[model samples]
Target: MTPEGKALLNIVILGLGFMVMFTAFGTCGNIEQTVIKSFNSTQFHGSGYTSMAIIYAVFSASNLIAPSVIAVIGPQLSLFFGGLVYSAYIAVFIHPYTWSFYTLSVLLGIAAAVLWTAQGNLLTINSKDSTIGRNSGIFWALMQFSLFFGNLYIYLAWHGKTHITDKDRQTVFITLTVISLVGSFLFFLIQKPDPEPAPSDASESLLPTDISDSSSVVASQGLGSQALDAFKKSIQLAMTKEMLLLSIPFAYSGVELTFYSGVYGTCLGAMSKFGGDAKGLIGLSGILIGVGEIIGGGVFGILDKCNRFGRNPVVFLGMITHFVAFYLIFLNVASDAPVAPEEGTQMQAYMQPSVLVALICSFLLGLGDSCFNTQLISIVGFLFREDSAPAFAVFKFVQSITAAVAFFYSNYLLLQWQLLIMVLMGFWGTVTFFVVEWTAMSTRKNSDYASI
Candidate 1:
């Protein structure tokens, strides 16, 4: 196969690998609260939410060092090792302990930082400006399929019941472990691209020559030097006006994701009258989210490829969708509503307006999320080009910190307050996107004039 054909093939394989890994680990991440709440609410003092906060906090910290780690090991090896760390974290459930759980959270955090940093770098470096949106869209859509199958497995495991038996929990752990292992193995099949030469004219590059060269340079010095340089580059990028403007929306996306993965399932479980079987209701919500994401990704990718809409318009639509979903959630659903069984048959209960509203909220959240996330990656790739590793690292850094803060306060806040905060953030994010787009257009016009 030609190099171009091989590159495309590798991208698809990597996407499929992530789909498997995410299905396994994503299921654990999404539904763990319900499972933990069911098994031993006292294990963390019913503070699974706090545990997640701790993980993202550590993840935020690790982002500072992750880029250097990827620089040393390369993206493919970084992904392989990171996948193994994820599998180990999943295996922790077999012999559960409080200390072990928190310890693994730290490991998972570091691993996540490495894995995602590598992924963004790999995808950006391999793609061209014209096709970047489509690549990201296809990749995200495929990865989200894990949510569908993972939730499907949970639904089957519960047997339409709300609570999970000890046997079922054990089976879940084992199955997830095996699936993660398979994903790690698939990373070995990916071939890393050869490094491109540094641009001759520094004026044409977004990054300095030293930093651009750093991408091709291995860690020949001591670990401390490599880390120091990486940290400096991260700070430099973070301080750029474009990066700051883009960060507002990126950080808000983090909070939105935390709500869907952490709080949404809990809300569904709380409203169900079927006892432990209510967990199945949460699974159903996840499936709907996956379906929405698939549709959103496909549509956005097509529009982008056809030049039907600019990135700003698509992102604006996403912000509006998110605002509407949150508003509906605030108005129609009550987390503290009494859990009396429906007056009629099971099907009638399932068809209740409030329940249906919650499900639709889940779908819209996923759809809006896909629109923003795919565009965020594509836009960053377009702006930064060769210096994408540090740019993506900073992006993840801001997102992690924001998400950590959201999860930390999540326990203290009521559902109404949480939704209100998200609405406010969404508004600010949309405004910031407008600023970022305007800046980009101005910069491009000047560059064109200079060329003329």
Candidate 2:
């Protein structure tokens, strides 16, 4: 590769690695997952979905704070430290330190938040709009695959024909701990290429290049120029109409994706990733979802109706497809009727309705996740000018905060009242439906926000 090409290649690899570590947190970081699955019964008892959700939410809660740290310190350090934090968190579990679990949860949330903002900012400045969306799409899709890998690795290690022993749970923590440390070393390779100034109409400002020893950017100092805020503005400025229109149908899928990614592993453990009819179906579900995501993300690039029907319809189709998947899963869950296997050590865990529900949910969630992410970025690009970095950044910041709060709340509810979280998620989906439809129609009534 030429010097410039090499830099780009390295950056992309860094970004990809960053995603790998970031995503590894979802599966490998879940202490509840490793402990509950490995040590517990074949039925995958007591995930503490509520407790784990709270832990996960506590970890996610740091999004409220990490952007400030990132804008001040900058992206490279955020990633380096984030990796170290993950290493520490995993090691805590490896040694079976229960007290560190809560503290580690919060730290992981905060560290990941900082890393996400910094990397997002870096990508915004370094790449073309189309290229950015495409890269983001690919990275997001690939990141989804990481969970499968984590599952495969953990399942194989446990190797439970009938049941997994708790002793092997140590392997899960150790594997992740090592991976996190290795990621830290890789983090050193990340270096800021250069700083670029925000445009005249820029609602947000990029960090200045005065790399202090502490490693923060200008935006990190409570300036609130974080990506979510930028993203919101870009949507409001460029294609408020188009986005609201698209968002009407698109929001339901978003709710589904968030809810399912949060729960898929729990389902897999109960179904067994390595064996049985349920296990076979569980594995099949994951692969199919990954494949669906690829197809959905590709659609983001090819859609030509953004100029006319707005970007709403593409999202609409994506949501409808997701709805079908969810419906199928719900039926499976509701049935509660058991399936009898003709062979092998059929544990009491197989043919679980809840696991079936989650499988259906994961597939639909994956489809929407793969499609919506690329579509969202592309939609922002269509709505905003090429130089609208600040706007997009703000958009991302808001989305992050909202997502963070929602994640926490989901867990809190799960803990407080088990089935309530699902009801709430479904209700949230209902609300999203109206938001998308109303926003789309309302935005279409006038060309007011059509500057781009």
Best of the candidates, TM-score: 1
Q: Per-residue lDDT tens digits of candidate 2, residues 1-452?
A: 44345445645566457545643454553325425434533432333233344343543445444545555566567768878877776676554434465567667656655665555555554545335545455445555555555545544554434443455556666677776676666656655444334445333344432222323433343445553443443444435544444443233333344455544433444433335444333334554555566556545533332434444455556656655654555444322111111122223322344544555566666676665565565545434433234333434444444344444454334211322433444444434544653564466566432221
Q: What is the TM-score of each candidate against the true structure?
A: 0.88, 0.67
Q: How many steric overlaps are in each model, in order?
A: 6, 40
lDDT by candidate, in order shown: 0.74, 0.48
Off by over 4 Å in 1: 40-46, 194-216, 219-224, 273-277, 302-308, 337-353, 445-452
lDDT for predicted candidate 2 compared with the true structure: 0.48
The segments of candidate 2 whose C-alpha lies over 4 angstroms from its true place after superposition are 1-11, 29-31, 37-52, 59-61, 158-160, 194-206, 209-258, 271-288, 298-313, 334-361, 377-452
lDDT of 2 at 425: 45
